[model samples]
Target: MQKLAGVLQNFFNQAHAKGRLRRECFGNLIYYRLIDDSQPFRRGTVIFEEGTLIPGYPQIGRMIRLDKGLKEQFTKPFWAEEKVDGYNVRIFLLGERLLGVTRGGFLCPFTVDRLPDLIDERIFSDHPDFILCGEIAGPENPYLIGSPPFIKEDIQLFIFDCQRKGEFDYLSQAEKHQLMEHYSLPSVRNFGLFKAEDILAIKQLMMTLDTEGCEGLVFKEDVPRGKRSKYVTSDASLSDIQAMARYLPDFPPEYFIGRILRSVIFLDEEGISSTHELKAQLGSAFIDGLLKAIKQCQREHRVYHRFRCRLHDRANARQLLAHLARGDGHIQIVKHRLVREGEFYIFEFDKVFQRTTGLLGELLSGEMVYD
Candidate 1:
């Protein structure tokens, strides 16, 4: 254990020294040694290697503008896979043992404990050089509201991509499917292929998934090394909006702001111009119920008088704060000050807001990228 800790510490030092890792601050959260996207992950990427756990990155999708449309984004046929609403994980075999890693390249104790039970040991033995990337979701997942609520026995790996060990290249979609079937591993739902003209159909499919309580869809190119993008569902928007205001005191303002901004993007993606249309599309009563729940939190202005937020992405946060200052009728910025603290900017603010609506609008105006 001590040796592993020392090796991990040394790895962090080297990554920092080489400028391969960065401290990315988002909202009130500070992510240490985040993967630097500028320097792409190559073979032998130094994910921590310790007792039965080797943490690494999972293939992630880029969020593109909905206005671009799926047909223009990629070539003819594209694979539209169901975007599972759960924690991202990478499962790999190390010697005789199997390990589970979070999307952030950390050893996930929950997945490490539970993933092994769902698979036959021989799968790892048979395919020693492949890393399976998927989601570890169910009741205990802290990050998302599980759709189709996973039963204990049903909470297993939902393999989406397979990458060769020590290589950035992934197996072809057909090969991946065959491998999963051969190994008896579960995979996410794949909506076969859609042509360039099938954008409307894809949109319908996304809406259908949203109605059925699924997160969204991930469109990957039919060919290898093709373009990939995701369309998040309105269900995700509703949950995020609720989390934004409900956990205001606990989570940073920018974090809340990011979620709100995503709501705006959600509107753009779904082709909804106004909130009334959104309410009707997502069910008027459902929106009312969520707004009512958030309103209760908004009414408790006295409880959250002064706040200190740590923003890692200060540039965007500042823009957002400035935008909020300009337009929002409620939520007056009583006092706003910032101090640099290493990779983070500590922001102190005093706010008095009567309605949450203004805050929500301000957030929607804030342009930020999703990781």
Candidate 2:
């Protein structure tokens, strides 16, 4: 363990000096997280002091044209699963403890506290070395504002992939399904298997999901370590724009532009020539979101996204707040934000986007500036 620690320390020091790594701790576990890709390691990779490495999840390329994307990307049958709208997390058993690590490699205290409510802990007991990759989504989730329409209350976990520790590849689809069934784990809804040429059927499925107000679909090849691609619905794109429009300055121009393009492509491919309703919806997404931000700033003197989550332990709630406080000074958590409600502690906070807040404040105050 000492030799491993020394080697890890040396690598972390170099990476930290180069602005590519960050070091943090939760209890007795000291870990190094990659902030940027460095040769063998991808961004969000985490390495613990005892030498457990949780590799970063790879980015899946988005496909605008289903017909061309499927043919060009997959040579074999692929499974189409619902691409949920939520923050990604990787859960694994470290010793006898189950912990949740976010995609950016941070040890999330909130997720750890809520794990039992989300999944069957016996899965970890059965497969001690398996790392569960899943999405935790709902209106009450702390990270994201958007949630699937189905989850009306607290967050829910939907396991999508599983990988063993020290292995870079995910388990085969069949293997993962078998384990999920055995454990009765909540998983992303599967739309069945499809060959590359099954574009019509896939399109029909996409339309159904869109009508049902789902995020989109992810196409994962049947084989182990197979390639993956994602395609989102027009409503999802519009919702994303609506939610983030208040903090538009915080994101790149391509963020909004890409969604617009995707929505257009989806409409065209679906052969929807009448776009009056869509145009109105898209317009309201931007206009209404910005209007709400203006009203909020006028009333509260600040603009932010309010987050609410519940934890079983009060200490974990405090710890989660502390962890968020360590971020880029945008979090606002008051003493009254953490309150006990029956058996759980409800915590609420706001993530202030200073760029948007400042910009709006200036504009509201009649400060003229050249863009």
lDDT, residue 179, candidate 2: 93
User: Cα-based RMSD of the predictions, in order?
Assistant: 12.8, 2.1
Summarize candidate 2's per-residue lDDT along 1-371 as a digit string, tens digits. Answer: 23355665677678889878877889778887898777666788887767777888788899998888899999999999999999999999888889999998999998999999999999999899999999999999877878999999989999999999867799988899999999999999988999988999999999998898899999999877788999999989998999988878766789999999999999998988889999999999899989988888888887888888898988887788788777666445443488889888888877887777888898999999996
How does each model score on lDDT?
0.59, 0.87
Model 1 lDDT tens row, 99-187: 66566554444455556565665777888877888876554342333334433423545778888765666678999989878878889
Model 1 ranges off by over 4 Å: 1-35, 42-67, 142-154, 254-371
Question: What overall lDDT, based on C-alpha atoms, would model 2 receive against the true structure?
Answer: 0.87
Mark the 10 consecutive residues where model 1 has the least summed lDDT.
42-51
For candidate 2, give the lDDT of residue 303: 80
Q: TM-score for candidate 1, please give it.
A: 0.62
